[model samples]
Target: MGEKGEVSAVGASRAAESRKIINVVYLITALDITWIFLQLSVTPYLAKKLGFDTLWLGYLQTTVGVIQLLGGPVFGRFADLFGARTALSLACSSTVVFFLLLAVANHPAMLFIHKIPTVFMHVLPASQMVVTDLTEPEKRADALSKLGLCFGVGMIVGSMLGGHLNTRYGETFTACFGAVGNVFSLLLVLKFIPRTTKDPRTNTESENKSKSIFNLGEITRLMKFPGVTPTFLVKIVAGLPSGIFQVMFSVIAMEFFKLQPEQNGYMMAYLGIVQMVIQGGVLGPLTVRYSESSLLIMSIGLTSLVGLAQAYTQSVFWFCVIVIPMMFSLSVFNVITDSMLTKSVPSSDTGTMLGLSASVKNLLRTVGPTAGGYLYMNYGQSSIGLIQFLVNMVVFVYLLLRPLKRTEARKE
Candidate 1:
């Protein structure tokens, strides 16, 4: 009877693992497709169309970041008490509604107000929990890389498709398609993600211990975790520059190169293509062989160079060419940061840590766009790129200041 029971348990465990893997794949694909239209294509287009100043863009992101800071812990704990799938589903659905609103948002303030809650509470927290729920410690980075690849590929396709659609059909039509894509993604989640009590925090005897509901305290504890502290600093600096770049891409295209909306979209599409190839096709496999620290350092150095290149470039082709390495570096850095955090964090705390990290990152990025706008307005395009390059240099130097032993461990 004992042997028979043990065999049965083993069979059940295998089945459960299989189910989790399937669910992870489904979630990754769904989110990837939806995010393409939301982030890379629509947001920039809207920024340009609405005539949002750099300060307004910063204010918008800052509000989101602040909300993320306030809400991340709450959401993270919620995932722990309830389940990741439910939390993720709610977050994704919320994003759908917010992005749909962007379709008709004519006022900068209106769009900014709508975006704050979406960025802070929904997008970052959900993504962190979903990835943590699906991956093991050793394989966390690998798993995240795969997930990132899905999004990268989706962005590549989405940018091209969105640009083409907007040019051919119109922004309204393209946004409708985006809404439809998100609806399909939500449906996929409902169908594929099973309701399971699979958090590593639960004990062996209580593997099926059904919890009451989400809690906020769990998230607070997660924010205080040692593993996440350093990464927060790095994320803040990186996000500032990235956020600025994100908000101003269209503006730069218009003012500097005198490119049309469709042409700007095309450039983004090309950049997305490079990111897709680098992140989805090349980076993951290389990660297995090289350590995270090496990759992180290299990504930072190259990104700085790319920033410098951008500062000097006057022609559209040169600007586009420089973007290739920039995107690649960004993707690699994100992968490494996530992987490191996952490995260092305790299983129970993954959701909270992820949320907090995102909150901080969003907060920092929020500063960038607004500041970039002011800088561009006052100093011109060359000055903006030069300052961004300086920011990257400081990041590089700060990381170097850490002890060699810890840095080496991070690579491992």
Candidate 2:
């Protein structure tokens, strides 16, 4: 072949591979949202129905996250040793089983205990790796944006569906249906995903060498990269608002506002729709036009405003009106922040870096829910907004002072 023709062919081949990898990530994100909605939309109602207190419900979910923090690295190592595809497939399949078990839990302890195993398998490290595996460093934002879009769309659908199902059929039925979705998602991964591993198909002695079950050292080394450290901090900061929103929204809807189960789901569905429109439909194109850093700042700033509104609003209708804009900004913020991290790190370390970050993020999440519950039960719903506003403000300051410079430098 001529030189130019040969180069064109090579580029096309790489592009095709990248597309396939992105498809896998999109599938994972779709499943992830479905699972999250199933958890968020149904779990609180179930807890309430079962006569569990706010603290008990929060403790149950927090226990799930605690296990995830401990399990994520072990799974990361397994992904490295086996293959990401294998680990991801296992994660998908296991989630289906756990969701089924979760469907049957009548007691709080049973529900809490059943939840822990699934948390490990929901390790986001795999999906993040799929993005890094597919795209070049310069193209990371575009790639991550696509993944984020899938999450946004899926979340909307899941929240809406969970609301419909729970309202129509009841919590147990909704949980069972979500399990079925997990099974379907597992099938999608099995059919679409390709294994990306350095090792050969056959096991070698070197690959079999006993590595420490917990390699704090290896994870620490990975974090030392300049690109990784700040990204990790960003993930930690991002976790607070997200965690608070996730845990507190349902509590406020169910407990303080005295909304029915379906009403609560519908409110979340509304948030999901606003977020999806902004993140999935708008943010990707906007990133190409505007400064992603500015968008990030705006999003965080707006979320704080929403948080404050959420704290003080007595009427659900007024709360929804304020929340519409908040959701839009949040959706954009997550896409931007994640794109930054995906762009910062090298492809080879994607799994380890994301796994470590997931551990830390989950740890923060563990705190947010418990704290949010405590605040809500004692001080009332306004406490959620106050805490979220403070945390996001701290994050916003850090962004302007530090990362804004980095983002501007990149743009220039």
Candidate 3:
């Protein structure tokens, strides 16, 4: 082709890639909103049906978290190998199957069995890989913020409506509906999402050597990159409070503040709104203005204070006030961490590095709930806050003291 023809072809290809990214973003948002719509409806009741004590629920959740941890890197690798569309489809499909299985389950053990397929479908890193695939380093954070915004939107809609659905339709009906929604998500993947231009197997020599999706050795080696280890560690710390508090938040609210189900639902919806606002609107603009390292550090310090406030507060009004900054801190921290991850490693190894990040995050998540449950059960509710406070402060100090230049957000 002549120069004009070549330029036209490149433009056409860019146009197609842009369209696909847009489609994937919209579809993922819808899929997640639908999934959260049904999933959260069941969480409040799952333990009741299974006759689970708090400790047992913690163990069960930890087990699920463990499976997800094991699956994260694999999914990352799958996205690298099979393409983000395929890996995401599998994840949604597995979620559909898992919900259906849960609806029919006679025992908690059945829920465990069904979660086997649940591990491999971790879609966050894979969805992120898609963004990384299509965007430059500077653009990846904004792209990722959109994904987080989708999750926030999902949470808001789901939390707003989940209570009503569970009350009106019943648990089995609600779960089955969630399954059907995921089926639609799978169909969306099959129909509208486009395939990648490059074959996964036909990469550069280094990429070819790291071809297998389940290559633990390769993933570990990737951690040695300049900004990779510190950012990954920070993410793990950021995730810990969630593991400790998220599963038990409702319990604490009900117990300490005498909150009702309706109030809890609204509170959760508020949290979702805060997350969406910060991640979708605030985070993207902030990245352009500040270094990711500084923003991440800010998030940690803020969350630490929130944790402390959470420990001392007795009034529901004060508790609700705490949620505002808490959610903001978390949302900003996550978006910045993702941006840092993209900048930490080479372009070709993006998925693999992200996979490792997801894997370690799950490991922390697995440990979080179990340990948090213990602390909550034995010590007190404030114990969760105390630990979170300490952890965030420690991490914030460490990151501030030893900043990595590579993880700074791009200016040019």
lDDT of the candidates, in the order given: 0.64, 0.70, 0.72
Residue clash pairs of candidate 1: 293-411
Give per-residue CA lDDT, model 1, range 148-238, as digits (tens): 6666656566767777777787666676677677677667666666554355334342334334334444445444656556775676675
The numbered model that scores best in lDDT is 3
Each candidate structure's TM-score, on Cα atoms with residue i matched to residue i, is 0.82, 0.87, 0.90
Question: Clash totals for all models, in order?
Answer: 1, 1, 0
Candidate 3 residue 316 C-alpha distance from true site, Å: 3.5
- Where is model 3 more than 4 Å wrong at Cα? 1-9, 12-16, 197-202, 253-262, 408-412
Clash count, predicted structure 2: 1
lDDT of candidate 3 vs native?
0.72
Question: Best by TM-score, which number?
Answer: 3
Total clashes in model 3, counting residue pairs 3 or more apart in sequence or in different chains: 0
Give the poorly placed runs of model 2, Cα more than 4 Å off: 1-3, 197-213, 237-242, 290-292, 402-412
Task: For residues 1-412, write the lDDT of model 3, one tens digit per residue.
Answer: 6999999999899868776766575557656664754565566466656887667767777887789888877777667666666777888888888888867867878766866775875766766776766666777777778877777777777766666667677777877877888888788777766664232444554445757767787767767877677677668866688557776775566555665545666776777788788777887888789877688889889989888998887787887788889888877877777778767666656677677777776787688768877887888888888888988888878878986566643221
Model 3: how far residue 218 lies from native, Å? 2.0
